[model samples]
Target: MHERQDVRTILNRTTNTVASIRFHLILVAILAFPLISGCQNLKPLPDGLSLQGGEFPSSEVAFIADTSWIDENGQRQVEQALFDDLFRIIDKAQEVIVLDMFLYNDFQGPVPETTRPLAGELTNALIDKKKQQPDMLIVVITDPVNELYGGLQSPYFEQLEQAGIRVVVTDLRKLHDSNAVYSFFWRLLFKPFGNSAANTLPNPIGAGCVSIRSYLELLNFKANHRKVLIADHGSTYVGFVSSANPHDGSSAHRNAAIRFTGEAVADLLQSENAVLELSGHAPVEIDIPRDHVNATTSVQVVTEGKIEDVVLAEINRAAVGDKLDLMMFYLSDREVIAALKQAHERGAKLRLLLDPNKDAFGREKNGIPNRPVAHELTAAGIPIRWCSSMGEQCHSKMLLAQDDTGRNVIVTGSANFTRRNLDDYNLETDVVVRGHHSDSVFVAAHEYFEESWKNTDDRIYSLPYERYEDRSFWRRRLYRFMEWSGISTF
Candidate 1:
């Protein structure tokens, strides 16, 4: 009996040692993976050829001159040529396609031909391509908040997955604003049952393949807010960092996308893969080399958590510069507001287009009145425009800056000039494009700004601000009850 006891103790010790070794191995692996994959080295532009134009150079890189147009009715159309060029590049994708959008939904239009959603058509095209080439790779990454509020669901994503394409939904937690009590209750009640008790709600995408990790990630503080598309391993499209979602509500919003070929696509793919890793998705294969292409035009790749303040700095730079054109769905950042005021004081010509709404995400914050920033700007003698669409909100974040000699700059992306967007609880990206070629693009964008400005009502805040107290007592009570119960997280 004594001998048997000794043998059992030895066996237990060996098992514990093996377990410890395995744990350490996993820890090391996790620590090393990000470091190995995160390094990226961009190459410098070659000599004798500047991003500015001398001749329409034919060497792999091509510059699409930006131009603005004024329609017969004086509607400003800036960057029309740039958008046309971008679409042309998308039309040329020959192989694998990947897209990540924050918001997307199918919308029925007045005409059957125009009824298809932008994402739906794009998905169908990818599906057809997958059928043709069995080995084709396709991917999509989207934000959960946009999916829920924008009326987008997983069936569409699952359909693409069934066709053997990769679809990843980034669980951006900050955007959801999950109530603390609700999350705690879910963790306590549902975690041990391993059943659909509370937190383990039904996966919108169907079946056993539902991602628990995604839902959990959404409860975190950081989020992946990028909206991008890559095709044929070469071409890429990046949506403007704005409130615009791929849904009917945001369809009418004025938005912009930048298209690029050559090495920039690879850079974008790497950035997306980083987000996927953070979301606990399997590591995506990195296809582009560290120093793959010499990017002639200046480009900056911004990420969440870090470098957020840098984005604000750029906005400030533009606002305080000689001339600034700003378009945004929401603008409540105190720093940005102060910067704009200072810029105006500095004799800068500032034009702002603000959405006449409470919040771009359709929520109230800090009991503040949901008035358009245009009112404040216009009162200060700055040209402020209120953009309105037939059925959708104006959802674009773009800034155009110019100096006396047409040295133009353009800043575009998903980052809103708001406290939540700038300080915490959102993911955003913005890029500054410089050089003469970009100047032309800026001019074109300026034209569009002017046209939209003309269409805006000068007195947007003249009407009395609606209050929640106007609702029926029962309705108000129900809303307050939901807020208290933590049901508002849904």
Candidate 2:
């Protein structure tokens, strides 16, 4: 009996040792996967990006916005011109139309009121254009979230595909990992299983159910968050970069865009070709006939990490007597926050209009990074205001800086001021417009901002910073943790 007991003990010890070895093997694989898979060494960025193009006439660049506000009777009203311009550009397309939008689905949960059918409209617009010009090269590039990471079919994407439009879903795996700790396990374990169109679990974003793999992929927190439109119009090419998406849930959100036609469009196309190349799509070669102008304004295409570089350089250059106005949906990038403070300290007048981080479709959210960051900025004597969002968000991402000499610089596009968006983890695109303050684009941008800042025409566009002041110590720490950890979406 003693010998039998000793044999049993030895067998149990061997079993425990095997389990320990297996655990360590997994740990080592997780630690080494990012390097072996080249996940951290992301695909090379497009070469032509961040290059300043030859100056075009200020008339060629237009500032468009979609504004939502409340009246004295507390009624929500929306005035939109951005999409109208976008559709008009689409109608004028004759040869090629390339649209790369982040969110292109109409996925709204149970909501009380009817939202604009932006997804259907955009789909119909593209389909109709395809039917009108059967030979037109219409390409639609979007993210996988619209399809729930292949856990479901996007009706809009199907319609676009049926209409002979080449829809390219961006390969998110080619991008750097935003949530590294979570992504390592996901790549090693879950990613190989691949997502299915089977619906076994309830969808987190909208109605209906989706596979669990969808949720697993969502934990990565990375995306191709670019909203760009390029099409040939008349004799030249036109391009648009905006913060707007054609998703119905975001239809009423305030957004901004810049539309231009010039040498800049070539740079924009080149940058987009890089996306195609990285995503395994054939690169498009379009020979844009550049036209000469009086060099009234300089427009440049800046994407991904280049956006951060340009924005920081502009903010750091803000000296005394310069005025900087920023309207952003998210503001949690530590470097940007510190730069703003330094700019203010150098006597640069700064006015910040930020979304209150309160609404997500029909859901209510606790004000996070925005609220805490606002608290920090207000303490530095920099004035801040909260967009009085009733249910929709103030989703504009723009910065307008004007020097005392009437030189103006406006940077606007799909990027939010968050670590995930600015740090090269997620894909993004933005344009920098350098011109005189009197330029039409600058004037329109200033008027758009002033209308909201001053609450012109009895429209309550924004509330004072005190409306959503977050003074809780714990919440502030939580905000920093989430930002650093990339655990929460900004």
Name the best candidate (by TM-score). Answer: 2
TM-score for candidate 2: 0.95
Report, for every candidate in turn, its global Cα lDDT versus the true structure.
0.49, 0.88
Q: Which segments of model 1 are wrong by more than 4 Å?
A: 1-91, 107-116, 145-153, 173-223, 233-244, 289-296, 305-311, 318-321, 358-381, 437-439, 455-490
lDDT by residue for model 2 over 234-283, one digit each (tens)?
Answer: 98899999999999889999999999988888878887887787788997
Screening candidate 1 with a backbone cut-off below 3 angstroms (N, C-alpha, C), the clashing residue pairs are 76-451, 78-444, 78-448, 79-444, 103-246, 104-246, 173-218, 241-413, 241-414, 242-414
**Which sections of candidate 2 miss by over 4 Å?**
6-10, 26-59
- What is the alpha-carbon RMSD of candidate 1 to the true structure? 12.3
TM-score list, all predictions:
0.62, 0.95
- Window of ten residues with lowest summed lDDT in model 2: 46-55
